[model samples]
Target: MQALLKNDVFDGNDGCQYRVVKTSSPNTGWVINLSRAHSWPVERDFGVLRSHSRVATQSTACAKLPDFAFYSEKARNRANAAYEVIKPLILNADGSENDDILDERKRNRLVLARADELDISKTTIYGYLHKWWSQGQSKYVLIPGSARNGQNQTSGTSGRGRMPGDGRYSVFQMGAEDIKRAKEFLEKRYIKKEHASLKGVHIDLIAKHYSFRDGNGDLVKRPEGEHPSIHQLRHVLKTLFTPEDVKRGKKGDKNFDRENKPMTGSSLEEAVAPGHIYELDATIFDTFLVAEANRHHIIGKPTLYLIYDRKTRLIVGFYLGLENASWTGAMLAILSLAEDKRALCEKYGHPYDPAHWPADGVFPAKFLGDRGEMASRNSDRICDGMEATISNTQSLLPITKGVVEAGFHAAHCAIKDMAPGYEPPMEAVKRRAKKYHLDAALTLEECTSLILGQIIKHNTTAMENYPLSPAQVLAGWNAIPTQLWKQELELNGCAGANYTYDYLHLQLLPRTTDDPKSKKAKVTQQGIEFENCIYKSVDDDPTVRQWMVNAGMGKSPEVHCSYDLRLVDNIIVHDSKGRTFPCTLAKDSGRFSGYSFAEVEYIIVKERRAKKLLEDKTNQAEMSRRQRAQAITTRAIAATKQAATSAARSARKADTAAERDAEKSRLRRLQTSMPPTNSESKRVGNVIALHSSDHVEGCAHQQPKIPVEDAAERPRSTIDDLLRRKAQEKTNELTHL
Candidate 1:
């Protein structure tokens, strides 16, 4: 309603005059004249170009406008192609047109027209038609009798299109249920099919099930509207289904690539010199030991951490745990190595001390582990209290840690293959650490121990690829000066107590002792309770005896007991036949105060309360039996009285019957006496009263008949009363007797 605004598109002045040019082509163009008062330089109109004459055909005119031709040709061509494909589908219900005859030229023209309307390529329209035709061929069929019945369905009128705004025309061709089923099928297939990738075939299947169409023209086909391709399907799967890492690549891919390089061999040789590098990593074992040594069924799996000298491939230390991999676990393994070193020295009389460690054993310079924080020795004391910088070994390098990483990778692959779908429960992981050893035939404490044993077996036996045992290589290394060899051995053996802290030494306080034999300061006692049941004490030291005595006296001499529980000897209790019972030292009562083996001796042969209980049970049984007998006697007495009552009732009924019979006879006699008066009574009624009046004074009234209850009928009532009276009499008689 608001008019005459001079905007960008229509900038003409209201009062301006213009001249219309009548061209030779019979069309008009306007030229602005700004001489009028209202006219200004801004008076212009661009739409005047449309008023100019141009060619009627789009080809000629479109050529003049190159940009339009550039974009429109493809769009028109695709639209035409889509129209050609849909033309027949729209024309007839059935594809009754010649099957073998494809009119390429006509199809091309139709496709171009469709593309022009839809603004899509002819090729795109062709593709959509091709897919649609492929999918519908089997399902879209017309009944043969429909045409004869006068149903004039049009050509190309297939069940492919829907009314405008119908939900069936959604871009997702398939219904919700069908899509869900498809997704589920693909997921299940992916779970089982290792290398099968989700892509185009799956998408096409979905599109075919539900008919969808793009809206551009009433019947024109869209070139861009086509089924998803393989790439698109893959994108959906990666984005929606698979884990990121699996979709991208495997973990440690880069390290594995580096491992493939030729330089790796040389680097390994240098870094893993006999005692230079020690690799450690944990492996979870799903299988359990088939022996009584580890009899309990593990809830999940056992985690075993192994430390090996890469050069000799000798296991330096090992730890097994039920816990998931942790920093504490890795640290404890190092501690085991330290304890083992001390043990080896004492066991073999360590010909050379720490001064000659290199000669005594294999010593490691570097500690290697996967990216586990506890395994890193970068801190002042890498494992809390552990001395990371030992006297003989050098600090480890970061690159060297990759060895352990490689080991972990190997374990993951191998173990997963052996135990498919197996994952250790947390309980089993925690319990594993409690057990120091597990034996294949018996039990082994550390996985490293098993690895060491295996290495020894492999080297010594002719069963495998290795030519020499790891121990042999270790022996060769040991041939150096006693000092150097012992130093190396000490270093290798000194896995800081952090790794395998279960050893008895870590639990005990370190005490210096003047050896009676060598006059050297040697550890006199070794046992641990807190650090894993280890105990260390000197049996012969006078000071130790004195300390024990004083400690015992502090809490009532009897209450004072041995401090080292692990050192206390194990004892068993058995029956006469020697069957042992599960028993242990009573913790509540201190060792000295608790009853002795002799005092508890009686418990061995007999149950403490069994005899008294048996006697009580017998007495109760006898009392019950006597009470039952008395009840039977009472029942017998009552039955006798009942029988007596029945007899008395029978007798009384017999007497009553006899008395009734006698009464009946007397009544008959009286009847006979009164008979003979029938004729006399008829003669004179006054004559009967003469004799009666004379005898009246002396006559006695005839007695009324008396009714009696039969004795049998009332016998039951009297019987009870009689019995009671009889019992009372019997009681009195018995008292007098």
Candidate 2:
């Protein structure tokens, strides 16, 4: 015979099932009739007694309890309230009924005392106790008979009426025919692309069906009291279709399917272990960011690509950049999955122990992402090289990658309030003007640090509602992503694939030669040139050197290469034999280092525009200067030609070398001895005047005289002395002749 355990159900020889609610002794216990009928006499049996003799003859079976989830909140509350009334009598400290209360007189006295304190009859309290003891000794069994029947307690409109305080409106009870008509009107007019209002549709229904023609054969509205209210129509509409169905009708199938569809399964359903499946998705952050080079220049919101582990809910990898959602950004994010977490965190200035984020170098068996990135032809590298399958979500349906989508929301919420240049809500924007870009304070690197911190926090913190497997629960594994990942890896023996970072990076990076539309990198005398930036062979690879030699020999060698747009510092150049060579940015292209390919391209374009504008202004100034010089030269040439006409050619020729020299000397001396010009005298006089009242005295008429000693001490001009010496020599030559 099986031992009678507390709460164990057993079959008695009397053809009734009993539950052991309490053990009174080693061989005896108090039992309750689990299969008791409502018509059974409660007082005739003060519960049942189970002994060793009864257990020896009876069979035991597992008890099947009711699922209270289906019960309404009111029903559950009523059951709990009734249980509170008899709790002290039935339940002891350890959840078993007290043996002292097993006596009929003692139990009745307690019941009567409870009834009197609660202002209820003793019979009512007895009924609650009998129901609790007869129905498996559960609080759920204390629910009222009407609620347990699963039928409306009141029959046919007994409790149905206009709610209290509803202004003098008449209550119009809708019949079957009225309901059918209302559903038709709602489906045709309200729940449609037109999105008609409920009140408007109700009015239209009245105009079409409930209205009568007036004396002049014109349609007229019926009295408000005679028609059903809009609320009645709305209630009928709700009964005919669910909220999702109504949304589908109004917003079209695609919108409802993407946003309003019920999620019956989890993103982890297909994930068997920590790295079984990974979800990838990208979103443009709401806040703006400044450029790493120049904080004054506002770069529009950066796009964040997240690689989320479905099984552990860990953010394995991410990429933050100014680029839009494209394959380039996705490639970087995928590379981050196998990147060193310690290095990545340190690079972003959020360093922590590797144990805190242990998803480094773990590759998922399958990659799931949106069509924008995963659907590209470049994504084939993930399948062919890494041996992983790519699963792309359907277009416009972000819910397919719901795990990563929620991750983006979590990351955004973590930094939204703290981040500078955060975009205000649409309602706030509508209320007042705001330029979020102008408020941008964080650089691209700083934003990346913030996002990294949030990811680390998420990975280390225990997640809410993480569904743990039975094995994990038995082993006491925590819900923290890092802990779950490490525990699962240890138990399951590493479900993720493994590859070196360099090897995987090379395989996954997009190849320019593979793209027909993109220009391949050309090897020239300057080195391998890509995207207008020169990449020289940093490592002495024979293949790269040969290519450079051939390029210098006038052969344009086009090399197949893969490069990360996020980092233009280096690129992987593939030789004809499929061997790769590392190439670094040339000295000339060193300015482009530390900048993304998009930023490099932007810088090039901007610089070109600025240079062109400056050149245009320079050319305009040069042209203006040339025109002014031409005008001055033309005027001087005309004056010289006019003066030549006034001189006689024969008289000029008759003059000897001595006379010519003497004439030049006399002119030089006369010009030097001449008094200062009126403008010059006035300029000097103004300086010596020194008084505002002496304005007239500082004019050309009041020129100051130089003293004889000062004038004599002033040496003759060099030109005048040289002329006098030349004239004396020329005159001596004439006398000797």
Candidate 3:
């Protein structure tokens, strides 16, 4: 085929030579386009040239070509088998191989004998041997009538499809204005802040005057002919866009980077020893955990912090929290690794054996963690205090700390997956669709025990990539992790030298400021206050109190204090001279006796906020009630005063009426001596009308004959005063009086 296609010329059926120009593959067979042959004189090999009258004729010969063949693994294996059988038979003619000569007769005899012994025909063995020598002793060869590339099959061209970030123009093709309208409909109806379903977007697009351009670039509309179907458009969308593309287009780059971007894998092949490197990370346990104290109350998911030994892939230690990840969890995990867990095991009802958990009090040479809780300044300081090299994994690269990451996944599979409230990845969505935690059955204590058992089983079982389990690899014992660690320790250990592992862990705990305003750590008569509790150094231990007493005497101006986040009952304080003092929880800390720092802190914050909220609500309700009471009281007071004033007015009206009658009788007696006037009859109509009476002058001459004591001591009634003043109101007498 290569020879035929590369040719510059080919003969036509008319005996005319044509120049081959181009070739292409279409729905039809291979077609060749050619130009007219040039007019060139032909020369004959014969002594005399024949004229056109001779009318010479010639014929072309053809032979059958075999199907395409190449050197495959099967063919190579067959040839190699034959060669192996015949290789021992071939010996040099001279015993010296350096002579590069072989006895052909001897070789032929040996080859035939070997073939007969192997039940292979003599001819086949000879053919294989001949081909081997002819092909420079190459065992593998391709024998065929047709040519083949002898390489893996290939399409020879890339597939016809859009790139990942490509648009589906061909799928939704139309005029610019129509396309714009379709996009507006899609975005407004589907891809906005409130996400909608794919079917919604499809229905919306189909409702518009949409058109499509097919693979052949012919525009078709629903009104004119057949448009792109929803299924076809869906296929185009899924093919043209990627998860990251949709993430960016629908949401934003942040979502695409956080959720859709691919993460690379990591390897532990570089690890050299069990205690060389350890990975630390925290994760939300998939299963819901109930309160240990009460099994019926589900506590939600737990934050599990694991310390994984990179070399052996052993879980050195772990810390489990109630429902969240925090720096305290990280500290507790380290504490678990540094201190013996016998008491913990006894508490949890797991068998206690130092040999089975040898890594209990050992620290690794290096600590690795992500840029979260483990990357804090306190964490760094703790690592420094413990003399371990601390390193942070690359941000967004979960694989850098792959050992812990994998450990978390393994634990989830071995334990969390089996729990009733188990939630897989994207569990939030599943949880929203159906409540899973509501059916939680395992309490924190029960869950912890199950997890411990799973870890122990993992440490003893063989791993896919490892010949032995992590425990076996670390301790060189086919037992639990603790046993392996213990056996290895009999030979060598590298946790620390100058100080004990417990002390080292204590050194890394969060430190408190010595500043006076942070009075929680101040050493008062009741001892130091921390987290609303008091911690006092007992004098029973002279060594411990010496640091305190010395610091008290102004021997040191500053003190260093660090508390184990794992325990709220105790804290370690180092004086300026570096003397260590252990402080115990004071009696005032009755409520916080057995609580961990994390638990206590969480409780304090939650309770405080809850109390604050309740107080605010109470205050608001009280103020509202007070305002209502004040409004009611104000109306009552005003009515009472109005009632009192109306009573006073009635009393004054009675007094005036009595005084007016008395004055009118006196005036009538006075009018008896004189002629009675028309105005006199109405003179005492009311005390206020007395001033308008014509008998005012006659009444003005008469004075009331009352006891002096009564006049001087008795207060005047309003009516009597009105009568008296009216009687004195005569024109001339009024001015004098």
Q: Could you say which candidate leads in lDDT?
A: 2
What tens digits encode model 1's per-residue C-alpha lDDT throughout 1-737? 11221111222234323322111123322232323432212212423432333222222211232232333344545545545555653344474433221234455676677677778787765655443332222112111122223233222212233333644332323334543555554565543455655553464444554335556523322222233233434444554455633432333345434443233433345542355666676666543433234545333445667665554444455566555676445545555566545464454333323432221233345555545543333222432233333221212332444444444444444434333223333435684453422322222233234433342332223322223338756765432223222344454453322333333223221221222431111111231121112222323344433434554555211111112222232222222343322222333212323333333334433554677769888999999999999999999989967667545555756678789978865554443222125477677664552333333333323442333653446546788989999999999999998
Off by over 4 Å in 3: 1-265, 341-346, 351-355, 416-418, 423-427, 431-434, 466-501, 513-520, 524-526, 529-535, 540-557, 564-569, 584-737
State in Å the error of residue 398, model 3.
Answer: 2.2
**What lDDT is reached at residue 228 by model 3?**
37
Arrange candidates by lDDT, descending: 2, 3, 1
Question: Model 1 — which ten-residue stretch has the worst lDDT?
Answer: 1-10
Worst 10 residues of 2 by lDDT: 39-48
User: Against the true structure, what is each candidate's TM-score?
Assistant: 0.27, 0.49, 0.44
Q: Candidate 2 residues 51-152, lDDT tens each?
A: 233442233321343566567899899888888888877778798656555666577687778888889888877888777655556767777676766242
lDDT by residue (tens digit), candidate 3, 1-737: 22222113344444443322222221111112222322211221111211122211121101121222335556555656776666665444353221111334355577667778998888777665444333223344324212234232222112233423554334323333543544565446544534767776766565555656778987654542234345544544454445555556677555555566677534545555567778899888888877768778877888888898775677878887773676778877777776656887887788876655656666777788888877776776655576688788767767567778888988888875578888776768653466788879887777888888877677766566544547556755554444444454555554432336567666767786544544235554455556767777755465444534665766433555787666788887666677777788877886798888778888889989999879988999999999999999999989977767536545756678889989877767564333333366478453332243464555654554655775699877999988877786775575876
State which candidate, 2 or 3, has the greater TM-score: 2
**Highest TM-score among the candidates is held by which one?**
2
Q: Candidate 1 versus the native: TM-score?
A: 0.27
